[model samples]
Structure formats: C-alpha cells, structure tokens
Target: MFTQDSKRALTAAALILATLTCGCAFESSPRGELGADQDLLKTCDPAAPPASFVQIDGTGSSNSDAIAAERMTAVEAIARRTAVCSGYLRVTVFSSSSAATAVLFDGALKMDGATENARLKRVPEAVSDVMNKVRSAYAPAVQALPQSGSDITAQLRLAAEWKQQLGGNYCLDLTVFSDGFQNIGVDLGARALSRQEAERLAEQPAVPKLAGASVVVAGLGRVAEGAPPSAVVEGLVSYYTKLCQRTEASSCTAVSDYATATR
Candidate 1:
C-alpha cells in the first residue's frame, strides 16, 4: 500500500519511462532509419545522369507477357537515352539464372568521341540480348514454379553489394521487376509468414542497408496466370516500403501496373 501522493509520483515516473522507451524504439526503427541520415540523401548528385540497373525475377509468373513487355520498354528507354557520364555509366541486367555484363561508357553514341559513341551504341543491343536471356530464365509453364521460390532477399543483398562496389561515387537508380511474392530463400523459422510477420521480418538484419540510391519496384500485383489477392498487393507495397527504408534508399515505390509506373 502507498499514500496517494507517492503513488501519483510513481505512476508519473513509469509513464515517463514508457514514453522514452517508445521514442528510442521509433528512432532506431527500420522505417525511420533512412530518414535519420539526412546527409546521405543530400550527398546524392543531383546532376548525375540517371543510370538503370534492372533485375528481372526469373521465378515463374502467370502474367509474364505483360511484365516482360513493360520491363523491356523500361530497359530500351534507359539504354537508348541517358546523359553523358564523364565517368563510366554502368548498365547491367540480372536474372535468377544468369546476368549480363555491364555496358560501361562515358557518353551516348551521338557523343563526339568515336570510341565512346561505339560503346554507347552497343548498350541498347546488349540490353536486347539480355532481355532474351531473362525470358529464358522464367519458368517454362505457369505450373512449373521452381521447387525453389524467388529469393528476393538474396537479390536485395546482391544489389547492396553492387552499391558498395560503386562506393557512393555516383547516384544509383535501381529498378526491380518482380511479382513481389518473395519465397523459398526466406527464413521464416520453418513456417509460412503472415503478412504482419513478413513486414516485420523485412526490418531485421537479414535485409541489407543501402544508402544514396533510388529504387523502383515494378510488377507487384500480377502473378503467374492471374492476379494476386488485393490483400497481397497491399501487403507487398508495405513490405517493399519498409525494406527500402531500411536500405536508406532516397526513394522507393512499388507499382502494380507497369504501363504507368514511369509517370
């Protein structure tokens, strides 16, 4: 038993402690991590020419035709038109089974240097070739989802590794084409993850951190042969948002309809 005044004081102290604890948690939370470092966002080169590194998920999908067409458009657009880079601009593609060599050059084919123009001219052609390679990486049939599912976490790790190699020397614009159904390589403690669980899991250390990058994720809602449930679509948007924030990407967006994604 306690006197009234003492009890009030104790309660107040407890409330203060709880408030402080909650604030600490939010400050350290994965969602807020990227915003914490305002400097990293500011450090990105505003003048840097846009560069695209596209990774196509080779996991089987039902609406692959739409996904492929939209994805190829983005690739061709980026390859054919990009600002001249005094330093080499890197354009590359990755699929579950294969990866294309980076087309590196200083400027576009229209640039004055013959060597630079020649290298730049090859990028679009190389991207076309890589698109074919990515198509082959997809499953042969809708029912033929691999025994192993899409390893999106692994792919994210790879992207982070690439960013590290790039070493903040240039701003990165990354694009990922996937159905947003991440499975197989993810560890959910031997069981499936509920939406809430999956979203929480994305904040954990298993996900890599990226800084000074902008990421766009396309082909989210559509699945192999049909569309995903609305709930799943919403969940993926949340999941990608959380994951991107953890990476410290300056921006992140998950678009279901690719036709309008660029807009």
Candidate 2:
C-alpha cells in the first residue's frame, strides 16, 4: 500500500537500524549487554576467576621421582631467585591420566593483588572437573570449575596473566601433558617473554614472590611410570617440538632427576 519512494525509505531505515544494532560489536562483537563505556562492553575480556588453594589427590604418582612439573617450579623460580616478585608457579602433569583436568590458579588465590592474564590455549578439559578422584582426595580446599568452555580458559589464562602482571601473589598450576606441549614450548616462552620482558619483570619495583602469594599448587600427578620406555616421564616433560630450542640445559624439563643431576 506504500508508494515506491516510501518503500525505499522504509528499507533504508531498516538497514540503518540493523547497522546500529550490530554496532555494539562494531569493534568486534555486540554480544555483551550495552554499557556506558567501551571497557565495560569488551566481550573478549575473561570474567572473574576463582583463586583458592588446591592440593592434588593423585593416585599412582609417587613423590620421590623428579617429575617434570617439579622442574617447572625451578624454571619459574628464576624471578624469585633474582629477588623479583614473579609469584608462585605451580605445575601438574597430566602425564598419566591423559584426561585429567587438574586445577589451575584462580584470582582469589592472588590474595587481593593486581592481576593480568593470557591463556595460551588447549589446557586439556574445557571445564576442570572438581568431582574427579584427585579432587576428592584433596577435599575442603577447592573450588569447582565453571560450567562453560570460556569460563575455564578465562579462569586459568587470567591467572597466568596475573602472574606476569603483578608478580607477587600469583600462581600457575599447569597441567602439562605430553601431547599438549606440542603447541607451547621453550621457544614459545622465549618468544612470549624475551630478555626485555624478563628485565621488565625483574626490574619492577615491587613486592617479593611469597609475601603477596599465599599460593596453593594442585595436580593429579598422573604420569604413568609404566615403563615401556618413555611415556611415563614424557607427561612431565614434553619432548615433542619441531622448531624448538633444544638443549639439556633448557628449563623445559624432562624428568626431575635428569634435570637435577645435569644442573
């Protein structure tokens, strides 16, 4: 019933409306609720992460053997040793239980401190399962994982970022598995944190590692020592890399004893 001109005008108006509606995501996505400021509208930023102490209730893993995760602690200890507050670094090896979804650090574990985050990606389970046998072993000191893929990554990646940013009061409970290490490696770390980044973190005028970091480390400690040859220790230390910085001295540890003896 409308004239041709009116019809065109209506179509144009509709198109403009659509554009405006989509504009919230103009920078990217208009998914999140409308906000007064751009920071509030950011959809990429991870949500608040939990930060409570978690102790691993690993079944088959023993405490004597020098696990690769133990050596990872030594790697992160560099900043602390140099009198820089790089926070606590916790690591767990899904070495055995390939499907084990161990607990990483949360924000609360940061214990009232400034935090930042960068989740590298593919940290095993999308949502860590607290109901696992391991968690059951370490009861009364834990928080269940969020019921979303993003929440899981955001929770952990932010914690890692929190470590990089604040230094003190930070923790990184990495569930480094054999296959999972294919992406991240010593080279990736070198690329991510060059000498410049190291100096920046080391030179920062702030707190020491432990004072602010009432950190708690957790893991299933499940790297099957079942000896066919290499599978057991491979969980703790991933030797799977193509263009990696290979060397016996590299902090990308293989086993605790070998690394210790070499050191």
Best by lDDT: 1
Q: Please write out the lDDT profile of model 1 over residues 1-263, one tens digit for every residue.
A: 76653453344333221221101101122434223222222332445534445566655552456556655555443333332232223433333322322222223222333664454444445545544544454334223434345666566677777656755345556666677674444443334446687678677647676665667666665565755566667777677667777777766666554432121
TM-score, one value per model = 0.58, 0.23
Pairs that clash in candidate 1? 61-224, 62-224, 62-225, 210-247
Candidate with the greatest TM-score versus the true structure: 1
Instruction: Give one digit per residue, the lDDT tens place, for model 2 in 98-184.
Output: 233354322221112243211111111211321232323322221232111111122223334445664432233222222121121
Clashes of each: 4, 14
Q: What RMSD does each model have against the real structure?
A: 16.2, 24.5
Candidate 2 global lDDT: 0.25
Q: Give the TM-score (vs. native) of candidate 1.
A: 0.58
